[model samples]
Target chain A: MSTETKQKKMITDVFVEGARKGWNLGVNNIIPNVLMAFVIIHVLNITGLLALLGKLFAPIMAVFGLPGEAATVLMGSWLSMGGGVGVAVSLFNEGLLNGTHLAILAPAIYLMGSQIQYAGRLLGTADVNSRHYGILFAISILNALIAMLIMRIFV
Target chain B: MQEERKVGLVSYLALIFAIIFFSGLFAKAAGWLGVFDFTVLNGSFGKILGEGGKAFEFRGSGGSGAKDGFLFALTLVPTVMFALGVVNVVEYLGALEAARQLLTPLLRPILGIPGSAGLALIAALQSTDAGAGMTKLLYENGEIDDNERSVFAAFQFSAGGTITNFFSSGAALFTLANADGSLAVTTPMLIPLAVMFIMKVFGANVMRFYLKATSKR
Candidate 1:
């Protein structure tokens, strides 16, 4: 075959191979987390645990320049960023978050959202060892704190 | 001894050239070069970066109605799964080893991680979960030391899977829809992203060097 035919064949082959591998990955590794996160976030929201936690952490959140109610967003974020952002929207609707507040919260939320659950689930699954989970978890919170401080000072 | 030296020098040079070449190819494949700006697949299939431009509305049904996290979950779970799946394919195929090599220049000098750590970091940039998974894979394989693992996790956590955000709720960060139907994307909206990146890198290195110092002691 000509070089051109060989190149075309190679491209198609790569695409097909990539799609199959990705499919397998999705099925085996990531989909479980998707379901797990969804359920946890849903249960927390339904159980009203998030709201209570929000109230509990209200003062600390104020230090972050966030309203006490914003704690739920933080709690949800511990489960996943999606959960955090999801909570954020509800907070915005309730008027607890304006543009400035949202902007400030966005950075830190983006940074450390999904900390605890991610560490518990993926770190072990990835086989990074169980001992470091606590440390990684602490770093996630620390990172969020730093990002929030940056936003409070700058944006 | 003389012949071994000749082979080592040639192999090192060849690896350098291969890294440069493959890195370029990876960037293009990932659409970082803006070649995918106008490209559209099917509607509902999602647009490339510059395509839709600014249609991000954060008011998912999670806020608008039911006041539950369900709607957001629908969006979030699928996206996480998909990003992981795609990256996994490449990783499973062992393409990440090459991407890992290519990204070594960026991660090593800054994060003090070995070249192989690039595989996980790159995955993390796209999906924090996958990045975590990759890092775990390294540890399980005995590819990284305890200190290296700690520092690397610090980096991943702080940076927090950047491109994952870009593809998910982060797309909204780039631009927000307004009451008047016009899109608003300002520099301030993006400040957090840049700050987060810098802070993560700083955090990782601080951990890395500190650990290195203490380990030496």
Candidate 2:
């Protein structure tokens, strides 16, 4: 290879190395938390922390026509859409929620869905952090709340 | 000065439009087979396109609604999980380091971000909270300064997380376009997508302007 081409290749190699390090720093920081979040979620279910929170979020959920127990889904949605759907599935299977209720919960679930921790992982892909992420989270929550309130009024 | 080859913002916008347009055409071609039904709540492409309105009452079967919702949620899980593994593997191979080496010098001059921050910026496009956690690590380690972090944060909020937008807003765009069988190309879903895009651009520029101004002072 010509000297110029070799030089260019070296430059490319260096940048790739740097980007890899940056990615490592990000992954190392988040992996532990990701595992922990999963464990916490499962533990919450087995320990009835899920049920406890359900009662707590009940009255507020009623404003949007969701059942008192629907709070579990809301919390699940906060974790991930699938997590939230897990809650919805359980609620449906238990005969506590109908398809319509799941439908009502859909938009809000989409809106403020991924809680801060998971959202952090997503934002991390682009190298963003907590304080800035908090602002977006706050905005998303407000959007979801208002949307649910409107859905209650219209639907 | 030579023109840069990086895709322009207009190209990104066009990509969004093109995806919706093609998805609609594909759906219509499928409809001709009488094999796939496209039913949204309260209305279908026929009523929605012909009348130019939204349905006020529930019209579809409830079971299908839940089924569809579950299916949509299901699709998202694998995408996220796969991203997690891919990110790890990429890190293991030092791909981000190459990206940082190539882009940081450019971004430092143009975007004013340090080379060390490149990976976090890319991750932010996937998820904000996780990106923040990564950025925090860089800051704590003194790899990036506060000003760089602030600017990076703003830029991320603006246009990152394309994955979510692809499924959520992008799916909506395709749904509306396909409703009419020939890509009517207009729908309520367009409003949110446009708003988010605008917010991302304007938000990033606003952040950059502030950081630059402060740096001079």
Candidate 3:
């Protein structure tokens, strides 16, 4: 029955189905993750912890032409890409990061994004050897770092 | 469980349309042509008067906490819906099958994996779990070996769910605008996308090299 209906489905129906998925993802995933990120940024800002982080990572982040506070965005992204975008936006609103910073950090976020979750979902499900996990993590971080370098040249 | 299907010209057209739709190349083109662009079509919300008679979107300015986040998240919903809708149409038109056909022959040179992994590779771009599940099946069925699985896993692990996730959440960054309403992130949308893809392959090769070196030792 499902296969028969699928064969009869129109392009518009397909679009609607996908849109429904997007809606669910928005309500369930994006909204919650982004809200948490915004609240976290708010907390970090009020506590001056964001400033301290900026100052602390300023030197390292300087290599990527980002402020130290931008480190928080990467950290957030490592947890979840949506959360990373949320943090990036929150900082952008506060004027800590400009458009150029966003461009530089964009690819880097996803390049190394969501590894903690993927470790379980990707590695665990695929049954790759546990011994290879460390190298896999290292390569991803390396990919992200190199991506930033390349992005810096362009934007 | 995908049945082998003939890749048609329509599939290639869909693939091309998908690329152009998201590329931003037609974003500022004159008149009707602008419809091809994602950003132009996604459009913007109307401005409403805020405190002191200043104009702002519904989200307002200088917002913080859950309230602000909620409003911000609200603005993102339409974009997500629209992007995914287009993705669905393109996919239904068989763009992914076209991609698999093109990608199959290059898998060995690019990732040191057999052409058989091509379907899983394309699936990985859309959904991490689906890709991982398929990859496991491929390995268990003896289509790919231990080393190849590790390298492919490296590709999937980093930037998992590349296409769907990027177009959805990553679209948020592309939608960002300056106070003057100019698009932020001046680098074209395709640039970051291409960069991430290149880096994914690079990461896979790094795993390939690590495997080769370790095996000899």
Candidate 4:
């Protein structure tokens, strides 16, 4: 639409339009992703696998000042950003992760988030050579690691 | 269709408003200034009495499994709606166009891509699909070469759909509180956002270096 017609559009209508988009995103993406994360965490908890994973990743996560279980957040976020947040929140609620951990993980989540989906959505669509895909993934993971280190200082 | 749209002063102001609105800068400010804050305006759910006479939001405490997840997701709906509503207003006023204008010049020095990629860069931040499509057009139309495309893809791939994804799902993290009800993250929202933007640039540079080194062989 032209600027003139857009200016003629009601502000309220514009807001409603955006809100409707948010509604769809929430229902279609956030809700499902979060629900799946929660269920995954629940299973991990009941099966004692969460503890084992934490023990395994504790030393590595410590470099970023996060708990070992925090690795799950990064793993989940790698699939979907919403899922990562859900996992982080679930850990926080379980008293496994504190506020500081969430703060540190926040930016890192999206920095490397959604690589699996974006491999197709972004790289494939942009027609970037598949040969360069490994480097692209590495760069994003490096970015997330650096972000966590930076955020740890602030929080 | 790729002609540059005129960015007016209103667009710049809209962009500024969008920044402060989501920046969490005035979240604790008293009086009218607080209204400029996203978290302040998003507000909190009312409390209800739970076990031990303690107050809890509708999601309550010690819940488990899909049922709890459903309720937790439900609580996030209004926040998502409000965030998107404000974002829509900002976009309608041309905040993005203003951003494109401001960013176009910096694209060369920063990402090593042409100014023409500015629109695609901005679009990518909002929607991955739009950005990717535009970027493909840029390459196919000979606006950018293969190496530049790789660098640009690195930027988009790292934090694709940044603004939309952040405000929609990532906003939930900003809402988390300690047991005593203090905000979970005292760091301003803008800080993380800035870090992501910087890292995106850094990642793109990494790709640029990689492509250059490999091509030399």
Candidate maximizing lDDT: 3
Between candidates 2 and 3, the one scoring higher on TM-score is 3
Model 3 Cα interface RMS deviation (Å): 1.1
Instruction: Kindly list the per-residue Cα lDDT of model 2 for residues B76-158, writing each as its tens digit.
Output: 23323332332333333334344444566666766676766666765654555556677777778888776667666555543
Candidate 3 local lDDT, A1-155, one digit each (tens):
23455458898899999899889989998888888888998899889999999999999999999999999999988988888988988888788999999989989899889999999999999999899999999999999989998999999
Off by over 4 Å in 1: A1-59, B1-103, B128-143, B157-160, B173-190, B213-217
Minimum summed lDDT over a 10-residue window in model 2 chain B is located at: B34-43
Q: Show where candidate 3 strays beyond 4 Å.
A: A1-7, B51-53
Candidates 1 onward: DockQ, in order: 0.24, 0.07, 0.81, 0.80
Q: List the residue pairs that clash in candidate 3.
A: none
Provide all candidates' interface root-mean-square deviations. Answer: 6.7, 11.4, 1.1, 1.1
Q: Looking at candidate 3, what is the lDDT of residue B67?
A: 90
Candidate 2 to truth, TM? 0.39
Tell me which residue pairs clash in candidate 4. none
lDDT of 1 by residue, B1-217 (tens): 0010112343344444333322222322453543322111100223233334644334332243333333333433333333333333333333534544556888768877777676577678767677877787677788887777888877876546675453345433323323333332233433665677777887777676666776687
- Say what the interface RMSD of candidate 2 is: 11.4
Candidate 1 achieves a global lDDT of 0.55
User: Could you tell which candidate, 2 or 4, scores higher by TM-score?
Assistant: 4
DockQ of 3: 0.81
